[model samples]
Target chain A: MGLNIKPLADRVLVEPAAAETTTASGIIIPDTAKEKPQKGTVVAIGTGKKDEPLTVQVGDTVLYGKYSGSELKLEGNDYLIMRESDILAII
Target chain B: MGLNIKPLADRVLVEPAAAETTTASGIIIPDTAKEKPQKGTVVAIGTGKKDEPLTVQVGDTVLYGKYSGSELKLEGNDYLIMRESDILAII
Candidate 1:
């Protein structure tokens, strides 16, 4: 769980939950029909901006908007870089 | 500026900056060429979450991403409802 890239200013780096590969009845899900994951584990955090410290922390599981955050690949791992407010709920 | 719609959890209501109607040389811009405005004034804000309180307040001039927030028409005026974190900076 280490990366050279670090988020800055209220941004967060999240490791998205794995997309569903199979359905409840064991039907294989196709890539085209798969939806972007909405949940993830916080891997890294930015220094909350001046006068606005973020409430989320490393290792916190969070829910985010379907289109929230920019996608990035760091060290062969996919990550989402989004503002702290993009997070919907802490689960 | 009042609206009946209230944003939920960490959301904020924004009144977008006026689109450019004329260029420096006084050319009339057409509606199709208008890009979504990136700056706005906060009209309303949510109470934030249990532990995470929002830093942006009503009347705060703020910057946001091009596609951030959902557009809504209230009382014949347009507004955007976005999570507080969508705000990039307060001016």
Candidate 2:
């Protein structure tokens, strides 16, 4: 069994591997692309924290980096996004 | 003038571009390395937020991904890491 963690604090619940494989310009990305985008879906989100309170919520589709958040497997599915700090942008 | 932001919440202050260029084997890293490591120093830290309290402080060395964290240029030198979530591991 994997972690059934409810991310604490400003952490977010994201289903990793949700990003589009192609660029916005409709260019099918090749494996050699220098900058790769990560795709994920927001499953759950933590309550707002200190000054920089939480802005996004569950079900929001987001994009992150390949090496951003710690890896986790839940119910046989891979997911991540425990902290809001790791998020580069909301999009 | 650039942003001298005091990161709010669980965000940590990290001096980007601080990771070692070589691996544990001391092999010189080639540019073609798939998992490229980004190096930086922790310059400042933010107060902890929510349940996941802040675990790091200023001046601590850290390592992150090249595509992680928002980019910033302070005083003619490039720097980043406004959020602790972006940090992959504390080295």
Task: Tell me the lDDT of candidate 1.
Answer: 0.71
- Model 2 has fnat of 0.00
TM-score of chain B of each: 0.78, 0.67
User: What is candidate 2's CAPRI-style docking category based on DockQ?
Assistant: incorrect
Least lDDT summed over 10 consecutive residues: which range in candidate 2 chain A? A25-34
Name the runs in model 2 displaced over 4 angstroms: A1-91, B1-4, B18-33
Model 1 ranges with Cα > 4 A deviation:
A1-91, B21-37
Q: Write one digit per residue (lDDT tens) for candidate 2, span A7-91.
A: 7787887887434445342323234334433556778777757665675567665544456776777777877866765554343
**Native contacts present in each candidate (fraction):** 0.00, 0.00
> Interface RMSD, all models, one decimal each?
14.0, 10.3
Q: Please provide, for model 1 over A1-91, each residue's C-alpha lDDT reduced to its tens digit, 9 standing for 90 to 100.
A: 4554346568887888777676454434344654533778898887787789899999998878777776544455566778898998887
**Model 2: per-residue lDDT, tens digit, B1-91?**
2234345455554555534567564534358758755666776565666577776667676666666654433344445545677776666
DockQ of each: 0.02, 0.04
Best by DockQ: 2
